[model samples]
Target chain A: MALITCQNAAFAYEGNTAVSNLNFAVHRGDYLCIVGENGSGKSTLIKGLLGLKVPQSGSVWMGDGLQPNKIGYLPQQTAAQKDFPASAYEVILSGRLGTRGILPFYSRVDKKIAEKNIKRLDIGNLRGRCYRELSGGQQQRVLLARALCAAEKMLLLDEPVAGLDPVVTRELYRLIEKINHETNITVIMVSHDIHSAVKYASHILHLQNTQVFFGKTKDYVQSEVGNRFLGITRRQESGGEAGGGEGSD
Target chain B: MIDILLEMFSYTFLVRAVIVGLLVSLCAALLGVSLVLKRYSMIGDGLSHVGFGTLAVATAMNASPLTVSIPVVVMAAFMLLRISENSKIKGDAAIALISTSSLAIGVVVISITTGMNTDVCNYMFGSILAMSKSDVILSIVLAIVVLILFVIFYNKIFAVTFDETFAQATGVKTGLYNMLIAFLTAITIVLGMRMMGALLISSLIIFPALTSMRVCKKFKSVTICSACVSVLCFFSGVVISYLQATPTGASVVIVNIIAFLLFWTANSIIRRGYA
Candidate 1:
């Protein structure tokens, strides 16, 4: 069963339509990478799917016992948010805020999940440390752990490796792949890194100026839209080594 | 110095001033962490100016200032938030525009209604005698309410202040909590204006939070330390005002300045030690 479905949806900001006529379904255990240009509304689509923004047209449906609150989100980091005064433990623990039943306090189970994620992310030693003082890779690890605590079934990440070094970025991608593969958690990631996206994602949603193509990774590589968007010829596509070719002109 | 302090506390008005000042300080500091973190600290200054304008009108109409000023200032706080959110005014600019205009209106009202009197001086630069017995009681009650509400919602506030978008995405009702913070800050600013004056009350809201952030990295620790620092500074400022015959509001702000410097120095030394 599909965990999430967006049917003929359109996302807008301040009456300006960003992306429209979007239709996609995310099944359980699918690693979906949403790749698009700078203003192609990838983040807006993610926001619409997460219920942060209402779709201007059509609808987004969460099924198979999935709800909006159960989805974890790791937003793109901003400089101001980076300076937030919080401990790594505190940041991770806040991921359970959605499940705490309006009591405004963390429960024992929440603490356990937070600790488990901390250990899973190998950030146990950084738990008590201040978030602002951590290195970029460590901070991203803490945030990823927080997102894990937020959703055990699904995770949505926006540019999670945007500013990290190549090594750290590769490590994060591996970690996310492990979570998706081992835990059967649905992963929908918005990324500018086309190389990593094609390498790891099971499914690819390529959004262009006025079009969106969603299909299996192999099929996407073979499709005309994919060939043009990924800048791969049919002969080179078979190799599966077309190193992160540029998107459509 | 001890004898003089004791004698100053012997006066009923001084006792009332101390009680109200300490309570207001505690509440201001408690909420200041979120305000500073959210970059809404200047809202205190804006609301205090609105309070001053309302107080001026109340005095002109021969009505109770607290009753008149509280609701008007609260409304202004909400308006400022709305304007900053929806309009092109933005945060700091909105604050500057609202505060300066309200301050001008207050000056005009005071001058036209009562001429150049001690009341104008008291409102601009606070006097210890500004707190009456009833005002003290009211301030204590409101301050306790603010403190209790803040403690109950501490975790939620922490989430909102850290990342408002994420908080809202997680179903935390970020709008309601933002309104709650604005409302509580309005009440604190109104209650504190008579003691700290319109111009200086914002310092009470900004200083303790900034000072505490120097030493504490966690929200809980910063909040706890801010409350401690606020109360200690208020007490010390009030005592110094009494003994040295200084303006109460100015004296308190000076104390905060000294405390901020001390904390900054200590934070630097500690960071160096760790390095």
Candidate 2:
């Protein structure tokens, strides 16, 4: 059975249908990329998948013992977090709170896992560093480690590299690809960088406030909607030298 | 200084005032870190205004002010949270709305019922003599409760404060935790209102956290430092208030200001050394 199955799912925002007509099933070991324009409901769909929002129509089913809280989530950075005072390790350890119920403090196992993920991300040096003081790429890596701690099976990332520079973005994408392929952990990312989305993702779900296309990477690349998106991003890449793929979906 | 301290400690009311002030100060400082991070620092000011309004009404009716004010301030905190969360009004605007109206109501009620007097001054600026035995006992119990809950939920609260969306996605019940912070903050505000007054109570909730953040890089360190700063500042403030015969709230704020400046200087020096 698929890990997550969403059929005819529609989500509304403030009484308006933000995204609708979604149909997809995510299997184990699949890296799915959700692509869209700004306000195209890519984020809304991510939220729905994370169980943060309920569909206004149809349903989102989780199979293979996938619980909503168990999904390791890497959310976009916020302004408040910019000046927040916390060590890198402290932020990562908090991911263990996903399954921690009524436990006042982190367990020894929780600490061990956090330390392991920290080492896995090769951020052992950053363990004592303040989160707010880290560079954008470093912050993303720290956040990724945090997500990995929570995600025993699946990782859900929302715009993990929004403001990162080119080299850092490449490094992050590579790391994510490595995590997905090596560990066989399912990866679902909402991104505006359609080019990187295609390069790293095994499957793509394109949305224009609804499902535009959902299929394998090769099929999506050959599909009309895929070509149109690839053409647009290609133009954007040529148009702007500094940015990766341009704005949100 | 030692002789004066001994003499001050001799008075039963002075002892009560010191004990209650310390507890309230600790509570305010503890809640302040999350409140400041969440940009809900002004919620303290807003709730205090609501508290003043309720306190005025309670006084007019010959009712015990703490009993009357606690529930009302807590409800107002919940209302402010709901308004900001569910409505078009942003958090700051909602706070401004509730705080100003409540302050106005308090002023109007005071003028009509009792007229402008020392009592009004006491409510606005606070007094060392305001800590009655019953109020001290209640404050101690409530402060202990706040401290216990805060410690027990420390991890969950950290998760919520750091990232609400991630915490929610992880099934942390972010709403309930936010409400818990608001609830605890309201109680602390009500408990401190009598001695810190309406205008200066929020300083106790904002200064220590900010001062600690200047010198501490880790959340645990910042929290521990903030609590220490709050207790020290409150103790010194009370001493200065007693020695100088000044308003308790203003004195506490002044002490906090001094501590903040000292920490700011130390942090800059530390950074300079690193550079």
Candidate 3:
């Protein structure tokens, strides 16, 4: 069954359309990556998915109850987030907020889920440390753990690895792969890094001006539009490097 | 000193003044951390101006300033929220335009109506000596209500401040919470006007949070430390006012500034030594 579905969605800010005529669906346990260049409305699309921005004229349906907690989302990073004053544990535990009763108290079961997620992310030692003081990679992991703490079925990430070093980016993608494989959580991430998306995504959606390409990764790599936009070449495959997609664009 | 204490205890207004200052300080200090963290410290400054405008209008109309100011500032707060949420207008610019316009209109109204040499300085700088029993009860009740809201919605608040989009995605209704915060801030500013004054209230909102950051390593600790520092500054400022014959609000703000400087300096020294 589809975990999320957006049909004929069009989103605009102040009457100026940012993204339009978008249609997509993600089934349970699917890993879908959305890639687009700057100003291609990737962020805007993500916002619509998270219900932060209402589409001008379309419908977005999530799970049966259509509650936010049923799906977790990670927005693009901000400088304010880097300087935020919460500890890793505190930040992670905030994910359990929606699941709590109206009294706004966290129960023992909630605490256990938070702790278990922290441990699962292997951020156990950083639990007491301030979130701001951590390295960029560590902060991203803490945020991921926070998303995991509450999310039961799907994870939506908006360029989660942006602005990170190469090593950190690779590490995060690996971890995301682990999350997809182990938790069986459907992952839909907005990304600009084509290589990472190609490496990790089971399916890819390339969003360009008022258009999109959606298909399996293998077919996407070989598609005429993907080859043109992503610049993939067969010769570079022998070198076994992402630069294989460098020249065609 | 003992004679002064005896004299102060004898007056019902003095007891009320102390209670009002303590309660307002406690609530403001806690809520202030969130405001400062979110970089909406200016919202306190803006709401205070709205309070001043309401006060002037109410005074001119011969109505109770408290009653008039609450609804007026509450409506102004709602407008501020609506304007900020208008994705077209930038948030800070919206706050600036509303605050400046309201304050300017208030000044013109006061000057035209009360040509009788209005002591606006007292409102701008505060006149704790002028607090009454009813003001104390009002402040105490506001503080209690704010505290209850904080405790009940602490997690949601924490999430919203840290990651607003994520909070909304997790079903927190960030827009509603954002409006609720703005409303609470408006009420808090009005309640605190007697203690911190219209001009200096934002100082109380920012300093305690900054000082708490120096000594605390966690969000909860930062909140607790800020509240403690605020209460200590309140009592100390009252005492110092008696000693120096100065205004209570200015004295309290001064004490808070001093504490902030001392704590910041100590933190810098420790960091340098460790490095």
Candidate 4:
């Protein structure tokens, strides 16, 4: 069964439509990357998926015990949020808040899960360090671990590599790929990097204001929208063309 | 100096002032960390002005100032939150509008009714003998309640203060917690205004948090150090005021300023040592 289904969904902010006529399903173990232009409602769609904003029209359904609150999320960071005075361990442990369920304090199992994710992300040494003092790559790793602690089945990331160096971005992509393939966890990511989206994601959801194209990556690479987005023609099979075609879509 | 200090504590009003001052200082410090981090430190100043307005009206009506002021300031706090969130009026603008208007109302009301009496002066500038026995009891109970609630919700408050969007995405009820902080702040401002004065109570909320932030890197340490610093400053300020005939509120603010400078200098030295 599909883990989540959205049928003819629409999202709006203050009665102004941001994205409309969205129909999609997230299957178990699927890696879906959402690609779009600026103001294309990628963040609004993620808000709808996370139940942060109610659908303006139609319906969003969750199945296979996949509730909205259970999905892990890694939000785009800002300068003010980066200056928050917290240790890496505290930041990651806070992700278990939904699971704790009105317990007032974290349980031992929550600590263990936090520790496991810290080890998984290879940030055990940085756990005791302040989050604001860490490098950009380390901070992203800490946030990723926090998201991992919340994910029982799926993870949702919003522009996770927005401001990172190329080397760090590549390392993060490998880490996310490892989690998706090894743990069979579903990955839904919003990205501006079209090349990495095509390289890493199994499925693609392309949004251009009200128009959307959701399909398999290979099928998307062959479609008109994908070809225009990826800057590829019917006869071209070269990978070098994928590099500069990032922000076009 | 010791004899003067011992004799000052022997007075009932002086003892009440110290007790209430320390409790208010602790509550202010505890709530200050989140307020400073969230950039809502000015809300304390805004609410204190509202409290001053309510207190002036309450005094004119012969009503208990605490009873009238607490609910009114809490409602104003909620209103400030709504205006900042839902309307085009930004947070600082909204605070300035409401605070200055309420302060004007308070000045007009006091002038119309009391006409610059010592009673009005006590609320504006804070006298050491301003807290009554009933005020002390009320402050102790309410301050304890605020402290307990803060401790219970420490982690949630930390999460909300750090990344409100992520906290809301994880179903942490950011709105409710924001309201909780505002409500507690309202209570703290109302309680502290009696001892720290309407003009100086916000310093009680801002100074300790900022002072601790200079030296502490973690939220927990900042909170702990803030509380300790607030209480110690309040005690020394009260004693200094008693000994040197300084104004209570100004003495407390001065001591807080000195503590902040000391902490900043010491932190720089420590950082240089590590470097």
Candidate 5:
């Protein structure tokens, strides 16, 4: 069964329609990459998926018999977030909040799981440090750890590595790969990095405002529709394009 | 001074006022961190103005301020939340609109009711000297409710405050928590009226959080430090008011400013030395 389904979904902010006739299905253990230009309704779709913005028409259905706590998310980071006064540990611990309900305290088991995840990220030493004091990459890692705290089966990352050096970007992708491969968790990440998507994702979703293309990564590379949607000249040699093409780096 | 202190101890109302002030200090510090972090530092200011209007209207109607103000401010809170969610009016602007309008209505209502003869100095500027027994009890109860909510929703609140979209993606119900924060803020504003008053209440909700950020590098430490600063400042303000016969709200705000300046100066010096 599909873990998340958006069927004929439509969303509007006031009178302006942001998304219309959107349809998608996300199964477990699939690494799907959503690629789009800015204001292509990508964030709006994600918001709908997360149940933040209710659809004006159609429905979004998370699979039945699954706990709500199984979903995890990493939002786009802003410069202002650096000055927020939360510790990395505390931020990560918040992931457990969904599963713990609205209770007054964290259980010992919850603490243990959170600690284990923190140590796994190898940022145990920095756990007690303020989230704001850390470098951007470190803060992102801490946020990733926090996302993992509650996310058991699926992870949704929204432009996780939007602004970073090449080395840090690769390292961050590696961490995400490890989580996906080792845990067999379904991963849906939105990125402008076509190269990285080619490297990591099995499935591709290209969105341009009302336009959308969904298929296997290889299929997207070969198909006429995919080529037009992606606005890329396909290379037959590697079934993917050449090095560091526009916005991919 | 000893005689005044003794006199204060003798009155149950005074004792209750002190206790209520202490409790509210903790609440202010706790919520202050997130408010400042969100950069919506004017929430307290906006909401308090709404509370002031509600109080004035209630007084004009010859109704109980506490009872009337709660629903009025709570409704205003919902309106603020709805307007902000529209993505048309910016958050600060929406807050400003509601704040100024309600205050204007309040001023008009008060003028009409009392023919502009009644003294509302205590409500405008804050006077711990005038706190009644019922006011003290109400503040205490409200403070406790705010504290309990914080303890329960600490994680969720932190996530939403830090990055709202991320919290929603994680299945954390960001909208619900957002409404919860606004609701609690309304209650805090109404309860804050007696001690902090309309003019200076925002300072109590903002300064402690900023001071904590200056000295503490960690989130947990910031929260702890903010709470301590709030409690300490409340009593010191009370004492200063006693000694100088100044307004209690102004005294507390002065204390907060001193702490903020001191902490900022010390932080800059330390950073400079290291550099």
Candidate 6:
């Protein structure tokens, strides 16, 4: 059985349907990138998957022993996170909160997992440092490690490289790719960076309020929708192609 | 100084006020860290206004003010949360709407019934003598409960405040924790109103946390520092008020402001050292 099945799922926002007719099945070890322009309902879909919002007309079913709390998520940064008075380790340790239902303290196991994630992400040096004090790339890495603490089977990231410079952006994408490959953890990333999305994702799920395309990466690139969107991305990114050819493995 | 302190504690009203004020400020400081970080510091001001309105109605009805104000202020907090979440009213606008409306209602109610009496003035601006024996007992018991609850749920509250979306995605039930924070805040505001005044109760919530955050880089340190700062400020504020014959709430706020300035200066100095 698929890990998650969204059968005609729709989410209402401000009395209007933000997104609808989402029909997708995420299987084990799938590197699915959700790509769309801003306001294209990618975030709504992520919320739906996280069980934060109930679908209007359909259901999002979790199967293959997957639960809502088990999915690791790295949401976009909020204003509260800026100048937040928490150490990077504390933020990362909080990811174990999913497994800590009703428990007041972080267990020894939880702490060990946090430590392991820190080591895994090579962020042990920043463990005790304040989160807000870290640079943007470092902060993203810390948050990614935090998401890793909760993600046993799958990782859900919403625009993880949104504000990062190209060098850092490429680094983060490759790191995510490495995680997906090494751990065989299924990855569902929402992004508008179509070039990197095509380069790293095994599958592409494009949205313009509804599914414009959902298939393997190669097929998506050949499809008319993919051709148009990639063309726009290429044109927009024409001047900055320094590391463009290197991502293709 | 010790003789003055002894003489000061000799008065029963001062002792009662000191005890209640310490506990209330402690609770306020603890909740303030999360509230300030979440940008809901205004919620304290808003709920204190609701507290004023309820106290006004309670006084007019010849009822126990604490009992009347506590639940009403809590409900108002929930309503404010709901309005911000579901309605077109954003957080600041919603708080402003509720706060101004409540203040107006309180003023109107007081003018119609009590005609600006000493009790009304005490509730509005705070008086040390306003901490009656029964109110002290109630405030202490409630403050202890608030402290215990806050300690037990500290981890969850930290997660929720720092990142509600991530916490909710982790299945932390952010709504419940948000409500929990609001509820505790309401209880603190209502309890502190008679001695800290509805007009000044929010300072007890905001100032200590902000001052501590200026110096402390971590949440645990910030919370600990804020608690100590608020408690120390409250004690000294009360003592100063007694010695100089000033209003309790205003003195405390002034002390907090001074502490904030000192800590901010120290923070800048420390950062410069690092640089």
B66: Cα error in model 2, Å:
0.4
TM-score for chain B considered on its own, for each of the candidates: 0.97, 0.98, 0.93, 0.97, 0.93, 0.97
The pairs that clash in candidate 4 are none
Q: Who is ahead in TM-score, 1 or 5? A: 1
Instruction: Indicate the worst ten consecutive residues by lDDT in candidate 5 chain B.
Output: B115-124
> iRMS for all predictions?
1.1, 0.6, 1.4, 1.1, 2.2, 0.7
Model 4, span B1-275: residue lDDT tens: 78987899889999998988898899999999999898888888999999999999998888999999999999999988777666566778889999999989988888898887887778888888778888989999999999899989998998888888788888899899999999999999998897788989999999999999888878899899999999999999998998889999999999999999999999899999999
Identify the candidate with maximal DockQ. Answer: 2
Q: What tens-digit string does per-residue lDDT give for candidate 2 at B20-92?
A: 9999999999999999998888888899989989988999888999999999999999988787676576778
| Candidate with better lDDT, 2 vs 6 | 2
lDDT string, candidate 5, A81-141, tens digits: 8688777878888777777665656788888888988877788988888887888789889
What ranking emerges by DockQ with the best candidate at the front? 2, 6, 3, 4, 1, 5
Candidate 6 residue lDDT tens string, A6-79: 88888987668988888888999999999888788988889888888889888899998998889999999997
RMSD of 4: 3.1
Global Cα RMSD, each model: 3.6, 1.7, 3.6, 3.1, 4.0, 2.5
Tell me, by lDDT, which candidate is best: 2
Candidate 5 local lDDT, B107-130, one digit each (tens) = 888888885543466667776765
Look at candidate 2 and tell me the lDDT of residue B65.
93
Cα-lDDT of candidate 6: 0.90
- What tier of docking accuracy does candidate 6 attain? high
Give one digit per residue, the lDDT tens place, for model 1 in A79-139: 6667777898999999888887679678899999999998888888999999999988898
Q: How well does model 4 score by local distance difference test?
A: 0.88
Better of 2 and 6 by DockQ: 2
Q: What TM value does model 1 have?
A: 0.95
For model 1, how does the per-residue alpha-carbon lDDT over B36-153 read when each residue is reduced to its tens digit? Answer: 8877877888898998899899999999899999999989989887875665557788789989998899889989999869998899888788887789889989998998899889
Off by over 4 Å in 1: A209-211, A232-249
Model 6 stretches with alpha carbons more than 4 Å out: A238-249
Model 3: per-residue lDDT, tens digit, A1-249? 577777888887556888777777788778999887678777777777777788888887776454556577777776667777788989888888877746587889889999999888899999999988999889899989988886888888988887777778888889999999997888999876777787889998878745478778899889887787666434344456533132112
